[model samples]
Target chain A: MKGSGGARRAPRSTPRPRGRPPGRSSRDGVIAGRDALLAAAERAIARDGPRVTLDAIAAEAGVTKPILYRGVGDRDALVFALAERLTRRMTDQVAEQVARTEDPEDMLRRLVRGYLELAAAQRNLYLFVTAGGVGDKRLQQSLLLADGAAQQFVDGIAAFRSARGADPAVATVWSYGLVGSLHYVTLWWLREPSLELETVTEHITSLLWTGLRLEEPVD
Target chain B: MKGSGGARRAPRSTPRPRGRPPGRSSRDGVIAGRDALLAAAERAIARDGPRVTLDAIAAEAGVTKPILYRGVGDRDALVFALAERLTRRMTDQVAEQVARTEDPEDMLRRLVRGYLELAAAQRNLYLFVTAGGVGDKRLQQSLLLADGAAQQFVDGIAAFRSARGADPAVATVWSYGLVGSLHYVTLWWLREPSLELETVTEHITSLLWTGLRLEEPVD
Candidate 1:
C-alpha cells in the first residue's frame, strides 16, 4: 500500500524515451541510448550494490547524469529499469540454454544450475533483484519475474514426471521444492562466498533426486 | 539476512510487574505489569505494522512511554523485544503443532499454512523481524529464530525424504526449494488477500508434491 504495486516499471536494458507520448518520432535513438544506459547501470550495480548511484551509472554509460536523469527520472527509476532488463535477460538466457534438451528433468536441472551459476557470477545483481529494494513498482515487477520462473519450472517438473509415469504428486513436490531451495542457496551463497557452487548444486540435486528421509522402495 | 520467517504468536494473557526483570525479586508488583505491557506491545505490532510508535505501544500497554522504556530500552529495542517474544511464541506453537504429527508431508503442509496465518495476523512484527534495519540486536535475534525454524522444517523434510530412499540430491533440492516457495507465499498472501489459506496450502503442496520437470523416471 505504501508504494506503487505494478504501475511503474523500473527502466531497464529495454528503454523508453523521456516522458514523450507514445509513437513520438525521435524514439529509436532514445530507446537505444536508454538501453545502453540501463546496461551500464546494471554493471555498476554489480560492482556495488543497490546503492549504485546516478553519477556512477552515468559514468559507466559514458553519458552525463542529466542525460541519464532525463531517460530514467531518478535513482530508483534506474534500478527498476536495470533489474527488469536483468531478469528478462537471465530468463531468456536460461530458456535458450535449455532449448535443445528434450528431457524435462534435464531441462529443469539445467535451469537450476544455470540460475545458480548466474547468481554466482553476478552476485550483486542477483542480490539486488532478489533482496534489494526499490519502489513498489520494482518490487512488483521483480515478484512477477520470480512467479513466472516458478510456474515454468513447476510445469516442466510435472510434465517430465507424468511422461515417465512417475507419481505426479512426487514430481510436483520435487520441482517446486527445488525452486524453493535454490532461492535460499542464492541467499546463503551471498553470505558465505567460499561455499562451493558445485557442492551447492550437488547437495540440492541430491535432495531432489533422493529426498529428506531415507525411505526405500516398497518392493 | 532480513525478516523473520512467517507466523504470529498470540499475545500472552498473563499479567506481571513493570520495570523488574524476571528473577530480580523485591519488585514483584511491577513485574506482572511490565509483562502485561510487553504483551500489549506485541499485540500492537501484530495489529499495527512495524512502524507503530512507542507511544502507541505504551498506550496499548495501558501505560506511559517512560514506564514502557524502563521495561525495555529505546524504540528499536522495544520492537526487537516484541519480535523476539513473538518469534519465541511462534516457535513453541509450531513445535507443538508439528510434534503431534509424524507424517512429513502432513507436517510440512500444516506448517506452511500455520506460519502464513501467523504472519498475516502480525504484519508489523513479521516485517520487523524479517526485513527490518540490521543495526538492532533484536533483528539479529529474530534471524536466529527464523534460521532455527527453517532448520527444523528442513530437517523434517530431509529426514522423511532420506528414509524413502529418495536421492540425496533430490532431498537437498526439495529442502531448499520448499523454503524458498514458502518465503514468497507469505508476501504473496499479503498482496492477494482473496487467496485462501487452504488454497495456498493446496497450491504449494501441489507444486512441491509434483516435483520439478517433465522427464523420465529415475528408476
Candidate 2:
C-alpha cells in the first residue's frame, strides 16, 4: 500500500522494482523514476491530446501499466502531479519576470504576459491537466492550482493595499478572483487563438488597470 | 436518437411512455413530464446532496430508473438541464433587478446581489450541477453557463463602453472574464459560508468598480 488503492493493487500484478538504478541513492532513484514517468506522460499527452490513457503513457515510458500505476498512483493523482508541475513552472516564470520589474504597472504586465505565454506554449498539457478529468478530481486540481497562486498573491496584494492606505482584508478574495479571471481568460484565448497575444494581454491589463467602467465615478 | 448516446441507449431498457398523460397534447405531456421529473430531481438533490444517484432520484420521483432515464436522458443531460434551469432563474432575477435601477452603480450592485443570493439559496442544487460531474461534461456545463451569461452581458457592456468612448471590441473578453470572476468568487463564498453575504458582495463590487490597484495612475 505505497500509494492509493489503485497503486496498492498494482504490486500484486507486478512486483516493485528490486533495487535503485546503479550508483544513485534509493531516494534519488525514486525521484528520478517519477520524473521520467511524468515526462513520458507529458509527451504522450502532447502527442495524443488530453484523452491520452494511462496505458498509452506507460507504453510511452517503456514500462508496464502496473509500473505506471506504482509510479503515479492513479489517473487523478497523476493529473494532480502534472498540474502541480505546470503551475510551478508558470509561477516561477512569472516570479522571475516580476522580480526584474520595480514599477507596479510593469510588474502586472509581466505577470500577465508570463502566465499567458507559458500556458500557450504548453497548450496540450494545460488542457490535459485542467480540462479533462472526473468532476471531484478536476475541481480538486483547480482548487489546488488556484489556492497555490492565491497564496503567492495575497501577501503582495495586502502589502500593496496597506501602503495605499486601503483595506488589506480584501486580499484573499481579490487574489482568488484575479486568478479565476486569468484562468478563464486563458481558456478563452486558447480556444480562440485568433486573438493576438498582445491584444488579449492589453484587454486584460486595461480591465484590471481601469476597472469595468471607462468613465464613471464609483459613487 | 432523441438526445446524446446515453439517451439513445436508454429507450430499449425503458420504452418511453407511449401516450400523453390524460388530455394534454403529446408535446405538452412531454414537457410536463420533464418538469415533474426535474422538480423531483431538485428535491432529491436538495435532501441528499449533490452525489445523490439516479436510482435515488428515480425513487424520489416515484418512478423506475428507466423512466427517470427516459425523462432526463442521463446524468450529464440531467446536470445540463439543471444548470440551465438554475442559470435561467438567476438571469431573470438579475435582469428584473437591473431593469429597476436607473443608476449604473446601482444596477451593478443589484446584479451582483441577485446572483449571489440566488446561488446561496440554491446551494445544494448549485453544487450538484456545477461542482460534481465527469471532467469533459463539467467543462461543457461551465462553458454553457458562462456563454449564456456572457451573451446577456456583452451587449450591455458594449453599449456602455461605446458611450464612454472605450473600445467596444473588448466587450466579449470583458463579459467572459467578469462572469468567470463572479462564478469563482461565488464558489469560494459558498465553500466558506462564514463570510457575510454583504461583505462578499462589497468586495466584488469594489474589484469590478475600481480594478485591482487601490491607488496609482496608469502610464
Candidate 3:
C-alpha cells in the first residue's frame, strides 16, 4: 500500500447466499441477519477454500438456510461481499496511515509495512483479493484503486522534487518504481509469513533512497 | 534460469514425464503419446481457462481419454506437467537474455523486457505461476529459481556498486528494487495489451541511472 497524496476506496464485493428467501423481516432483523450470514461466510471461507458452500455458512451462522437467502445472495455474491469488506478495510488502513504522517516517503514506507502485516496476519483475505488479479475485473479494479492511492503518496514525493526543480521526468519514474518495488516486497511478505514486516520495509526504504547502477569490477 | 547458478539439471518440478523406462525408445509410444498430451495441455490451456479438464486435454490431443492416464497421473499431475513445461521455457528465455549482454545494466534491462514480453504473450502461464506465488512450496522454489536467475542480473548491479565501495548494503536493496519494479510493471501491462513495454523499461532505467530520489512535496 502506498499512501499516495490521494486515495479512494476500492470497489465493493458481495457473496450471495443460497436457499429460498426467509419470510419478511423488520429493518433490525435485516441488519442482524445479514451481519450474521456475512460473519459465517468469512469463517467458512477462512477454514476451507473460497469454495465453501452456503449450507456450511448458514449452519455456522445459526440461521436457517432461508434466513441466509433473505440476507445474502449466492456463494459468489457472498464471496464478493466479503471481498468488498476486506478491501475497504485495507483502503481505510492506508488512508489512516496518511493522516499519521505528512512526509511522503515515510508515509509510503509505513503503508507498505502496514499492509504487509495485514497480509501476513490475514492470509485468507490476502488470497481472496489477489487470487482474482487477472481473471476478475472487480478484483483488478479494486487493486487499481489501491494502486492509485499508493501513487498519490508517490505523487507527493514527485511534487517535492518538482518544487526543487529536479528533473520532473526522473521524479515520475522514481515514484512509479517505488510503488512497484513496494508491491513486490508486499507479495514476498504475504507468501513468507515468517519474515518480519519491519525488516522488509527497512530494506526496501534503504534501496529506494539509493541507486544500484554502478560499474563492474576490473580484474 | 540464472543457470541455476551452476546447479544444472536441477528439477524443481515433480511428476514430470520421465524420458524412458528400460527398453523404451526415445520416440516410444508412451513417450510420444505423453508429448502429444503435454502439447495439447498447452493448446487447451491457451484456448480455455486453467481448470480445463484432462478429458478435454486428451480429446484436444486427438487421443482417447484413457491414453492420458498412461502419461499424466491425476488432475494435479496434469497441472504439474503443464506448469513444468512453461517454467522451463520462461527460464530458458531469461538465461538467453542474461548471456547475450555484456553491460550489467543492459543485462538487467533485457531480462526485464524478456520477462514482460513473455508474461504478455503467455497469459495462462503468467496467471498460473502467479497463482502459485503463495502456499505452494514447489511452485515457489521453481519461481524463486526463476526470479533468482533474474535477480542475478540485478546482483551484477550490486557487484558493481560493491566494486565502487559505495554503500554495498544499499546496493543490494536497490538491485532488488529494480527487479521488483520491472516485475510489477509486467502485471500492469497485462490489462492493456498495448502498453508500451519499452517506455516502461526506459522510465525505470532512467530512474536507476540518474540517481534521483524525490522528496515530500508540501504545497
Candidate 4:
C-alpha cells in the first residue's frame, strides 16, 4: 500500500516467489521483501527489546531465518539497515523543523528537542540498533548514524559561517561535536528519565548558543 | 614494590597460593592477584587488540581461565576494571595539567590534548575497554568513564559559574556535554588518524570557548 503501483501489485504474502523471472517487477518485489523484513525486525525489537534474536524477527515476519537473512543479510547488516532507517527519519524531522525557523537559537532548540523526542519515542529500537552489539560493528553502526546526522548539518553550518565572514572549515568538527554531544545526552537522558526534557534541551542550547563561559571576556 | 609493605612481601608469581593461611597478609595477596590479572589484561589487549579473549589474558598472566575469572570476575567485570584503571590514569593526568595552569583556556586545551594523546597511546586498550562489547554492559562501562570525567569537571564548572554570579545548575549538563563531546571527538580522531592532535584540540577548544556563532551577537 505504501510503495509504487508495481509494489502494490506484487503479492504481499509472498514478496519474492521462488524461481521467479528476473525483471523490473521482480526487482520491486525484492525491495518490498527487504522492507517487509525490516518492518518485522522493528516490531520484534519493539516487542522483545534489544536482545531480540534473528529467529524471533524471522518468526515475526512469518519467514524462516534463511529468508530473513537472504532479505537483509546478517544481524549486523540488519542493525545497520535499521540505523539507516531511524537516522533518516530523525534527519527528516530535524530538517523540517530547521526549515520552519530562521532564528539560530530557535533552530538549535528545535533540533535538540526534536532529536530527544524522536529518540525517546523509539527508545527500544534506538537501543536495539545502536547499543545491541559490541566491537567494530557496533562502533561502525553508531558512527554511521552520527556521521549521517552530522552530514545533514555540514552544509547548513557552512552556509551560516560563510555568511558571517567566518571560516567554514569548523563546520565539520562543530557538526560532529554537536551531533555527538546530542547522542550522548540522549543516552544519558534515556537512562535517567527523571531529568526533564526541557531542562536538558535548554541547557544544551544555552551551552552551544552562548558557549561555556558565562562571564564577560576581559579582552 | 608499588604497594605497601604487606603487598611487597606477597609473592608476585604465586600471588594467591592454594591453601594459604587466612590473615591480613592473605587479603593483601588477594589484592595483588587482582592487580596482576588486570595488568595481564592490559598486556593482552595491547597485544591482541580489543577482541583478546579471557583465555589469552589468563595465559598472559601465567594462570588458568578459572584463576583469571576468580580474580577479575568475568569478561564484563574485567572490562569494567580496565575502564576504571584507564579513566583513573586519564583523570590524574588532567588533574595534574589543571593544577599547573591558571588560564581556563589553557586548562581546557591541555585536557583535550592530553585525552587525545593518551587515547592514541593506548589505542588498542581504549578500543578494548570502550568498544569491545555491546548491550547494557557496554553502555554502563562507557558511562562509567564519561561520568567519572564529568564528575571531575562539575566542581570546576560550578565554581567558575558561581564566581560570575551565574546559576551553577548548568554545571552538570555542561560537564557532561564537554566530556561526551571530547569522548566522541577522540573516537572520530582515532578512526580518522589523518586529523592532527593539535588541530582537533584547537577546534574543540575554540568551539567550547566561542561557540558555534562566530559573529558578534545582535543582542
lDDT of 4 by residue, B1-219 (tens): 112346546546776578645556544445448899899899988998787878899999987787887888878898899999999999998788877987777888888888889999998898877776555566567676667876666567556656554444466677767877777777777877766789889988887766776674433
**Chain B, model 1, TM-score against the native?**
0.65
iRMS per model, in Å, is 5.8, 4.4, 5.1, 3.5
Give each model a TM-score.
0.66, 0.77, 0.68, 0.82
C-alpha lDDT score of every prediction, in listed order: 0.60, 0.73, 0.59, 0.76
Question: What lDDT does candidate 2 reach at residue A110?
Answer: 77
Off by over 4 Å in 1: A1-32, A53-69, A74-76, A134-142, A159-180, A206-219, B1-86, B133-146, B157-176, B213-219
Write one digit per residue (lDDT tens) for candidate 4, span A89-166: 999988898779888778888988999999899888988777765565565666766688765665565566565544
Model 1, backbone clash pairs (residues 3+ apart or across chains), number: 87
Kindly list the per-residue Cα lDDT of model 1 for residues A47-73, writing each as its tens digit: 866555668878888777778888776
Per-residue CA lDDT of model 2 for B1-219, tens digit only, reads 224445444446556776536654456445438889999999999998777889989988877777888888888899999988888888887899888977766677777788789878987887777765544455566655566765566567556556554454587667767776777777777766767888888887777767776575332
Evaluate model 2 with DockQ and give the value: 0.31
TM-score result, candidate 4: 0.82
Q: Which 10 consecutive positions of candidate 3 chain B have the poorest summed lDDT?
A: B133-142
DockQ for all models, in order? 0.18, 0.31, 0.24, 0.28
lDDT of 3 by residue, B1-219 (tens): 112346467667778676534564545445446777788877887776544556777778876565677777655466566666765676689779778878766866677677777777887655544543223332233234234544555555656656555543344445446655655555555754453778766766655554345334445
**Model 2 over residues A45-119: C-alpha lDDT tens digits?**
888777788889999998778788888888888989998888888888789988897776677777778878987
| Chain B TM-score against the true chain B, candidate 2 | 0.79
